[model samples]
Target: MTYFFPKVRQAQQHGWKGQGNKAGGWQEMSRVGAGARLFEATAVGIALLCLGARLEASELRKSPVVRAVERASPAVVNVSTEQEMQRRPGMFPGFRGDSLFEEFFRDFLSPFPRGQARTSLGSGVIVDPKGMVLTNEHVVQGASSIKVTLSDQREYQARLVGADPPSDLAVLLIETKEKLPVIPMGRSNDLMIGETVIAIGNPFGLSHTVTTGVISALNRSIRTESRVYKDFIQTDAAINPGNSGGPLLNIDGELIGINTAIYQKAQGVGFAIPIDRAKRIMRELIEHGEVHPAWIGVEVQSMDEALARSFGLQGRKGVLVTQVAQGGPAQRAGLRKGDLILSVGSSKITSRQEFLEALSAYTGGSQISLGVVRDGREMEVKLKAESLSTQEAVRMAERQLGFTVDAVNQASKKERRAYSMSGVVVRSVEPQSLSYRVGIREGDLIRQINDKEIRSLEDYQTAMARALRRESVTLLVQRGSYGYYLTLELGGGG
Candidate 1:
């Protein structure tokens, strides 16, 4: 519970009771008239009072999140992730590294911890009566073991059902002999800015922690470890690190979002994945093994005020198509660079996020209706979406990393140029990432593995062979601005 009051108020109007001595002053007959008006106002006020009371009673009854926490708490579980540490060679070997001293001293001295477990805890909302759960993708990223404990103190080893890092959401499945009570999902699109929202999660590993606040804002964008998730619901709902993956519910106990992140340094600033997006991902994860995105073969940029005028954009709406991929769906549909996409199907596409979101609703091979504006002319086109390959999906996911990567496709000249390296090239650094943490990215032209200057596939192979043997190794590299080294620690078993 965070609380804030508005800083401004509307001015109230005051009137004289009646005309007394003068026209605007109180007088006997005027007083009688004023009394009648007061009587009417009093009756109205009483009626309003009764109506307010009734509404309050109804709201109290409908606030199921508040009422049902005690019962649902048993289903809301706490999760902890763990991974084994890689073994690192010691400063002095054959001190027979088998002693506790070897374990403790080696772990403490080595750049990478040895046999140590990196752990994180978070909360989850049970969505299926069979013990299937929902949580944030970050909560379980890189985790080799996932342990879930129910409110009743019973524990289970959970398996990852599916996860969408783009949306920063994940789902887990635990087979339990007993039935579980799942929370109902509510329509987050219907939520208002000031409507009450309840967050139930295990913050700081505290089970079933409940917090309340109002919807602070909507359509927020937050950068996670893997991607930039857009259209998040903002709330001052006392969310913390462990709160990630818990359900953000409305007064009726219907889930509106999946609590995902909070500003560590800022108070009352938290974010959640809107239930609508979560629902879409959940469907794909349950149906396929992964979430599939709708792809239009075009690079898009948002139409800002300055760019809109420069491009002579009409009506100040739609996203600018910067580049249309050759032979892609967009190019085949006749979409060209400098064109502005106005809509997908019936939904309007005003920004890049909106354009992407609108397309996510459909799958490959579906005929997509698009409206575009080009050279002062309005045009429409229908495109048949092609099913994206796993490689393509990986490329799309990498885009959120703010890096330039090329898949290994030697057929096309452009692809050959881009795919010279077996792995994607590091074009830029996203603010949050292990690569960024180590300070090695952006225009680096990643050429080698540990101690091996790599110019070709054989070089990379030889380097990886040596690097994988050690717990941690340094990548010798060159950058556009300067040359440096990057030490990468291979985390425990995945």
Candidate 2:
């Protein structure tokens, strides 16, 4: 990568004396050649330019990452992993299922080879003095031979302590007689946009390379090969292919982020896992070897000003429960379809992410109180949260049109101020549920059944009993404030 400079041209006719110079009496000219003068000037200019570039390059080489790597390289270790993978010549194309090339290539080219040792390399941080290390999960995804290289050039076999792929964070442990230098963890929340950050990692097998840049953005969502990391701290830090699992530190020498991914097509944009989220996952992994999150089994949506006004909500706050899964904890506790969830226990949940964060903070089987608004009535419901089987959860998520009703009562109207209605409102029909398949919901409001006009719970029961008697029945339904008609529907299928 050499850069060429433009060739300087010499001025002609240097033999003739200039009028400005002292008059020469046609004597042997003392005047220097223009070409020589141009050559000398060009040499001096080139030397000055070289000196300036050297100074600039020197300054860039001494930047923050360069400085941090010098100080923290001792704690950063290289990891080599070996894993075992399935090998079958028939499983691949251009294979006879019996060739040595196929068999050997399958084993040789894999990150995890069959029966033989497969090697991978990445960097790690020895965060604990007791020899606990932090690295990316991808580094040890299926490793069989894990090695750690210290700054002193000593290599030691390491073992996986725990790993969480959702956060792309992993922990390793090794035995040593002496304590290793640890990087101090810092609060990533204190980071501001444009604040300088340093990335220290082993890039392209080049150990202890440092790159520096200011925080490009905060709370970024990044998609990587490992996981979809949300709330990442984006920076201009020069992270390359082999920089995974390295630390992104603040100026005060504290680990703020974990260098994880970079935008391949773009320049100066990189992302790191925020230290706070990583620490939470690490604690769970190191302590329990698995993370157990509380499951409420309800679909919630954020309440915006428009939705709040439409729902006639008091203060445009709290997460709105859009749909409660059948047989879930909320459903078992009598939580209905159109309830506005005010809070879970003492903490107020404002968004879906906040709800998930709050829920993940709690252990499974914890009983919590839920504040909700039903038909404009504020009530407290005690929900004993339980983790449901995957199959059961999937089943519950599908029964959306099993029931239909309208917001008719005063309390229901006040709670659903957005609808601007006084009664239970029938919004939409779920396709696969019993009601929609039998022609229900969308505009049908229960006016009455079997000669009785349905107005409340008692009236609804009476109408339902009569309608159930007929395989297909008709019910008096109100389409608007004044219009009413008979809506026939089939029963006994759910």
Candidate 3:
């Protein structure tokens, strides 16, 4: 076969043709057979190359990260909002006939100019087929108009269904005749650290951007200047300004958390609200348009050096129970005054603030376990929370303060004339009560409870209900021409 191919190539190069001679006919026949064999060999090589290339591409496309992004992206949305900016006038009084001067000083005096609109961009995930989108509350806060752009480039007007500022979660509704794609919800309570996670959002106004990272930590707490946020899902994924309210998905393409950019100084550190906590708040928002405060009827105070020593804490951290409401969840669960609460569920309680933060994750009827140290013995007590009511709040306040109050308008003519203010007036005081021992007297006008202003009877009730969650409340009391700020310990009274 080799000898014939060489002879055939040499004969064809020399212009040999099969005209009439037998040698010419043999050369032509050999050349024809060799040419057909060479063409078939080349075709086989080309097919092998194509098959190898296809196999490599198929593996890359089947990657877990790639598949997760593909499954979740369709439910992700770009949220843009428009808000009217309010202008502040100059501090000085208005002057006439000084148009030029006013114009010159406008830039220096006024905080902002009128008739300007502010626009913001963020991300959202569709959690329901009915077009209910979930995002951060700050994304749509004070928004005059909101617009949502789906991954398919379909735009629709969105209206706020409900917003919970404390949880930083909001729900938006977009009415469309067709059903929208939704992301499957996953539990955050069992999320493992260092697990792969994906973040999809509209960072810097770019829509449907995807980033990948692992869960950095769980049950993390982040503090800002104004307030502290707890129970966050910390991740290494890049969460920028517009990434707020985006979905944080696990490797299985399930929604585990809602990404948040509250900590602005983060370099590789990003935080999110755990889906387990968000789920309770979302249900409340969808049903009642707000998250109601849950009460367990126990007042806790921060442990001080003296109190810590008295309770034999040594160096342990916990809050001291100052009071437990009668016939309430805490009382029914065997919780008592002077008991030190070491923890709430799995979270250790060091201060009153931390205790409140832990309890905020739950709603009414939630059964929670409390770790307590009673008489130097450690024990766990379980209690169920109840929705706070005005009647219960008033009863608690009366028993704790040992004082009964009436609205200022319902006071006697002489008392009203003497105390002309918008607050609640003490109608009677228990002689042997803590309030009485602290120099609180009848006819005292209560102007504020903790940080809440008391302008009406409803305001007073609401303030007392919130104060019930704390171990002590500071009251701003006005008596005669003098005013005083008194910190009163709640619970035990005459």
Candidate 4:
């Protein structure tokens, strides 16, 4: 390539040099003169070739992106999961990809029922030398089996420690006798926008793919489920579907955040969970098998001009308290309806999302000084953080199938009847839950267990008891609009 450009120049400027003596430019009487000219041309070509080679080598070293990738690439691993997916006739299996499809592809709504295995791939950072890996909770949520492949080509079966769905984080433990590479975490709070960062991930099943880009923005919010808010570090780095749970590193090769969500349809738009926010959540998950987000028992909305005028507030800023739970922390702190929450501790509250985000910074039982405006007067109120309440069905499911479900009541049944189904509604499926391995889903209906029809909670309990004793319990499940049969083994082998 280096010689091609000079060759083109030589052809343009020295086209007459290649002509015979008949051409006037090379009119030489002796062969010795022509030989001298050839030698001079060869020397100049050599010098130009050497200079180009040196320039290419010099520019390659100027980039630290390669070195940064080498520094953190070893700690990155590929996370692969296998789940049994059962599809019934005339039902929507749901869109589980990272794209914003709103619904699954319309073409997948088949008329024939089918059951098959599903495989999902993502990336993870080995934060612990003992083989404790951190990944996005959605990657292994409904997986029947989990596997982690290291950079050295060694694969290990991973065990789920805990899952925090609201945060989209999960911890996994894998037994390894050999020394494991660990990724050291840096402070995300110290990160500056426009600083160059590297993203190491497995995008589209390609392992250890490195992408470099500057931090485009910070404190970005992406709303997935209603009431669940996510603050992400926006970067121009190419983060694809399989890059979830990977590491976003600084030039010094320190992890600043974990890559979680991305705008699939758009280029140069990716989001990562800050390392600081993930650290506490990781500790809580590994210790308690659940995340206990601090709760104040007050529902709030972003303050608007209309609400501020109605409440007779000063500035139309901060969060507006809509409802306060009786006997809760807000009530105990003297915070009431129509009051505006100005701040939490030292952080200013601008919107309901910001208020919730500030509250997450506190753990259970921590005393926090809150700033609120009432009757156009500002005052400070103190309250202690408490663990958020768990639904009764979730508690029961945790004891039974290691998941959460709601009772199939008249109201719920009416909705289910659209699919010609009946039974409980699955709210959340815990990682490695018993029902998960058998291809059960959040929208699936549990109609019968071991040949016992279950239309109500009492019937479900009775059926569960009998199903627990059988070697392999068969259940008639109505998943969306299609009813199908699923068999679960007694020992969670289904």
Q: How far out, in Å, is residue 318 in model 3?
A: 2.4
Poorly placed runs, candidate 2 (over 4 Å): 1-71, 90-117, 224-227, 262-266, 294-299, 302-310, 313-319, 322-494
Candidate 4: minimum summed lDDT over ten consecutive residues — where?
Answer: 98-107
lDDT of 1 by residue, 130-226 (tens): 7778888889888999999887888888999887655667889886677776777678767799988888888888878899889998877565442
lDDT to native, each model: 0.68, 0.66, 0.84, 0.74
Residues 1-494, model 2: lDDT tens digits: 22322222121145334444436422223233454566678888999999999999998788655565666667778777877655533455665665786657766765545565666678888888988888888888888778888878888888888876556788988767677888877887578999888888888889877788899887665655422455678888888766888888888668887787444554667788878767766766678674444456676666788887888886747777777766778788988765787777654767655454345434346677888887677899998776444333323322422555554656655543323342235545677766666565565565555455656644554345323322334555555455454445332111
Task: Please report the TM-score between candidate 1 and the true structure.
Answer: 0.60
**Model 1: number of backbone collisions:** 6
User: On residues 316-397, what C-alpha lDDT tens digit does candidate 4 reach at each position?
Assistant: 5998877676787879889888787888876688876577667765555667888988887889999986765443222323
Model 3 spans with C-alpha error above 4 angstroms: 1-52, 90-111, 304-316, 375-377, 394-405, 408-415, 418-455, 463-494
Query: Per-residue lDDT of 1-494 in model 3, one digit per residue for the tens?
Result: 13245656776677766555778668667677878688778788889889989998998778898888888899999999999888665454566347775676666665555576889999999999999999999999999999999999999999999997767999999978687999988988788898999999999998988998999888898888645788998999999999999999999889999999988999998899989888888887888787666778887778888888887877767888887778889999999998988988778889888888788777776778999998888999998888878778888788778998888774452764446558888888999998999988888888999777898788899888767655578999888878899999765210
Q: Write the number of the candidate with greater TM-score, choosing between 2 and 3.
A: 3
- Name the best candidate (by lDDT): 3
On TM-score, the leading prediction is: 3
Compute the lDDT for candidate 2. 0.66
lDDT of 1 at 131: 77
lDDT of 3: 0.84
